[model samples]
Target: MTFVTKIRLQSGNRPALDRIVDEIRSTAERKGAELRGPHSAPPERLSVPQYKSTAGDEHRQFRSWDYTVYTREMEIVGHNELARQVTEFDFPDGVHVEAELKQVEQMA
Candidate 1:
């Protein structure tokens, strides 16, 4: 039996996210976890602005901006133990985290 652990991390602190993702990947590989794509979601959408055309405006266009981000995913062979390990995974300061466990298989 196996389970896939989906880890959702929030935006902000790009460098920290990069380092953490790399570390997690390395650790998971060393531990023989069959992991899939981290599948990093797009940056956090923070602001959107709209302005009417002005006489001297260089350009007239609405704009939207977002903060960049990173995402990581890991596989778990032993559901319980892996869940515990995931909980203990190092998270950068001020970063938000959420996890969802999907059952991939069931062993008799």
Candidate 2:
């Protein structure tokens, strides 16, 4: 049996997101754990309209906020403890990480 840990990282700040991914990659390397990748996904763009008042000011019609969320995914193979360590790492502000573990059976 093997456990595959899938890690997903997201943040509106690209620099912060890259930094966290680098840290995780380096840590896994240092621990001699097999890491699949830091595969990047297309950035997700989001926009929200802003209104200062219920009546809606003249400027509010064109007022909106836009942000891009960058994402990266990686797999940690057969290392539950290492996966835990990576998941428990203290990441700086503006970065978010999620991890999922799944069991896989070996084929004969």
Q: Which candidate should be chosen as best, given TM-score against the real structure?
A: 2
Instruction: Tell me how far the alpha carbon of residue 56 in candidate 2 is from the true structure, in angstroms, after superposition.
Output: 7.2
Q: Top lDDT: which candidate number?
A: 2
User: Model 2: per-residue lDDT, tens digit, 35-93?
Assistant: 99899999999998878777868575755889999999999999789999989898888
Q: For each candidate, how many residue pairs have backbone atoms clashing (under 3 Å)? A: 0, 0
RMSD of each: 6.0, 2.0
Candidate 1: which stretches are off by over 4 Å? 48-83, 106-108
Query: On a 0 to 100 scale, what is the lDDT of residue 79 in model 1?
Result: 46
Which stretches in model 2 have alpha-carbon errors above 4 Å? 54-62
lDDT of 1 by residue, 68-101 (tens): 4555454444445655676688787956778788
lDDT at residue 13 of model 1 (Cα atoms): 85
lDDT of predicted model 2? 0.90
Please give the CA lDDT of all the candidate structures: 0.64, 0.90
The true-versus-predicted C-alpha distance at residue 107 of model 2, in Å, is 0.6
Write down the lDDT that model 1 would get.
Answer: 0.64
Give the TM-score comparing model 2 with the true structure, all chains together: 0.90
